[model samples]
Target: MRLLLVEDDEHVAAALLAVLKRHGFTAGLARNGAEAIEKTQAGGFDVVLLDLGLPDADGFEVYGQIRRLSRIPVIMVTARADVRSRIHGLNLGADDYVVKPYDTGELLARIHAVSRRAALDQASSDGPASGGTGGAPAPGGQVLTAGPVTVELSTRRVLVDGARVELTRKEFDLLALLAQRPGVVFRREQIISDVWRTSWEGTGRTLEVHVASLRSKLRRPELVETVRGVGYRLAVPPAL
Candidate 1:
């Protein structure tokens, strides 16, 4: 897979480039936010590893620019580890974030996880024909029925045992992604990209935060199961 690495520190960039190359990734380097945005738009990279501190522009500004043009997955690599910075990055549509001095193994794992999730989402989007006028019943109209909960994609609505359940846009999107393939695990990075349409800016907690909000509104909170060390999946209840 091709990846864009944006960092001003020469040593850091060199080290990461070698590591990413060793992992069979075609890595592109950018020294500043402006170059990062430019290279990103010009190249078809599978993912982007961006640094928040850039000489030309703030990392957030670069993120905003990239998000405006493409939905390419992004992973933020920054020295800032504070909660506020992380949350702000996420709010601006970053997919994941990795603090400086991070382990190479962890970063590689994150990249693979995000990539896999992207592939799954693309498959789902391109799978069977979903939208069409009245005709034979469409299989894409399959409603995920989980006990008291029912999600209807055709109507973009959710109901708990027949009663409508109010949800924010992000919450609804997250639920729909999970309900699309019950029991299939989705990493936090995948959830953020597929549901939020943002690159991974290194904030996996965003998934937990949103999931907590979703569970609070769900009739059966247990329907969404946390798959320790992986991500989350919709639980399949016992047959009646």
Candidate 2:
């Protein structure tokens, strides 16, 4: 896959580029935010490995600019391990985040996962609409409903009480997985395997954070129930 590596440190960039090349990936390097934006505008890369420590500008600002330019998947690779920073990056619509001192195996796995997701999302978007209307359609996708909440997999849209609810990619994936089998408790490991598609130490916490975010955005804390010493399950809503 073609990847854009945005890092100001030459040493770090060199080491990473070598590893990436060995893995059969064609990668281009960008030392600063402006160059990153310029490359993103040119639009040939499949994914971007963005570092927060940019010599010219803030990485977050660069990320915003790149988003405005292209829909290429971006994975934040930095040393900022704090929850606040990670959440901020994810909130900015990043495909994933990898803290520094990371394992090469995990990094490669994340890259593949992000790229796969982007491809699927793109395919869904380019697909035909349902019912001869202008709305998105899912040939094999299902429209799941629980109470006042509706999830359209084809368009990746969510509606709560007839009001649109904006959700991050991960949030939507978590919700959709549970919505598919309401009241069925999904094991923590199982959830991670299915949603994140990677086995990592931080995935459990990430799942908890995503669940919290989903509850807050859906404005229904009771919608998702956490089983003691178990994982979680989507609560079946009462009939209106």
* Model 1 RMSD, rounded to 1 decimal: 10.7
Roughly what TM-score does model 1 have, to 2 decimal places?
0.55
lDDT of 1 at 63: 93
RMSD of each: 10.7, 12.6
What is the Cα-based lDDT of residue 179 in candidate 2? 77
Those runs of model 1 whose alpha carbons end farther than 4 Å from true positions after fitting are 129-240
lDDT of 1 at 101: 83
The numbered model that scores best in lDDT is 2
lDDT, each prediction? 0.77, 0.83
Over the stretch 176-231, how does candidate 1's per-residue lDDT look in tens digits?
77775566676666677667666668657677888999988886789889989868
Alpha-carbon shift of residue 217 in model 1 (angstroms)? 41
